[model samples]
Target: MTDIGYIHHEEHMRSSDLISDIVIGMSDGLTVPFALAAGLSGAVASSSLVVTAGIAEIVAGSIAMGLGGYLAGRTEADHYESERRREIAEVESVPEREKAEVREVFAGMGISPALQTAIADELAKDKVKWVDFMMKYELGLDEPDPNRATKSALTIGLSYVFGGLIPLSPYLLVSHPHEALLYSCIVTLICLFVFGYFKSQVTGQPPVSGAFKVMFIGALAASAAFGVARLFG
Candidate 1:
């Protein structure tokens, strides 16, 4: 097992939808509860209050975020199904019109009229395939994954719980609100930077810049919340 300098392997692909769900969930999970904790810290003297409130917010936030993801997934599925049905109906009811539309598609791509007619005619022979092609190229839609709704719900909910725990962890260890806030800020800010760096890597942005950007936004939100709380308290 000593000959592994450079190996060739097939490239693996990952799902963009899952990545999007994680980004949506984790970003909010990290920021919102963090800001809330910072604000609560400024207002109260007891760490217990901050911890209790933070846990409550985390539970509520996870459920709300998960439900939102599930709804979005279901809506996407519904829209795809509706369009699919309409496409099927149109194809069945108007073969000639659909054939002409197919030719138009090829024609727009700079194919010669004769070639366009030939291709379109061949495509029109198979109603199912033609409908599928039209759905993809003309309507710009892909079939939705059947498991998308349930998967998105779980992913977003779990990610929120994980992210919310970072800032809330410090309050569990300390007795005073300010002391807990100090530790929470340190831990959460580091996690945010790391999270943003990896997120940028996946999204094809500059890692350092993205990290700073995320960190700054979180800091700004927390600072604003803390200031408001202190002023009102």
Candidate 2:
């Protein structure tokens, strides 16, 4: 039973974190570069320039996403560690107060006062477990593995490059620049809609609405960029 419980907990934690990372990585990788390509394709006449921009966007965007994810994850880990230390200090120095707070928290959640006191007593007996429990239940924080951050960043960045390629591939193969631009736009829009729908599913929102919202925003941005470029060109 204990082994089963541990396995379930570990699996849940890992799967949840993985889904979040994939969604974030794919979202950034696919949308921004696609938008950049779509907008630039309209303004530029040369296939060489379009290809150059697409390649640049993929490489630059991947690095940016990777670095950003790594730094963000590192910062979060640092903050969590700091807080955990603080929590330990408080538990050691002002144990009665912290215990009382824990009792109250449980009581407020409808645990009987007697049970809450008993639970708190048991928890306080094991200082490490008590601190961990407090962090999870009271503070709603889980200590993330430091290495996962780098892995997440690299995964996301790579995903972004892949997603970005979807929109740019048509332009690379087709000879007609105008047709390429149209096909790229179509592909990008379709991908965006799908991405938005999946994002909405993961986030518990209306899928169609979310899809439309992203599409509208991307369309607006692409249109604005195209208009500005044409005016300047």
* Best model per lDDT: 1
Q: Which digits, one per residue and each the tens of the lDDT, describe model 2 over residues 39-96?
A: 6766777766777888898999888888888888898899899989999999999999
* Residue ranges of candidate 2 with Cα displaced over 4 Å: 1-15
List residue ranges in candidate 1 displaced over 4 A.
Answer: 1-15
Q: TM-scores of all models?
A: 0.92, 0.86
Alpha-carbon shift of residue 71 in model 1 (angstroms): 0.6
Residue 110, candidate 2: how far off, in angstroms?
Answer: 2.1
Clashes of each: 0, 1
Candidate 2, after superposition: displacement of residue 233 in Å?
1.0
Please give the distance, in angstroms, between residue 154's alpha carbon in candidate 1 and its true position after superposition: 1.0
Instruction: Please give the CA lDDT of all the candidate structures.
Output: 0.93, 0.80
Scored against the true structure, residue 66 in model 1 reaches a CA lDDT of: 97
Q: Give lDDT for model 1.
A: 0.93
Model 1 worst lDDT window (10 residues): 6-15
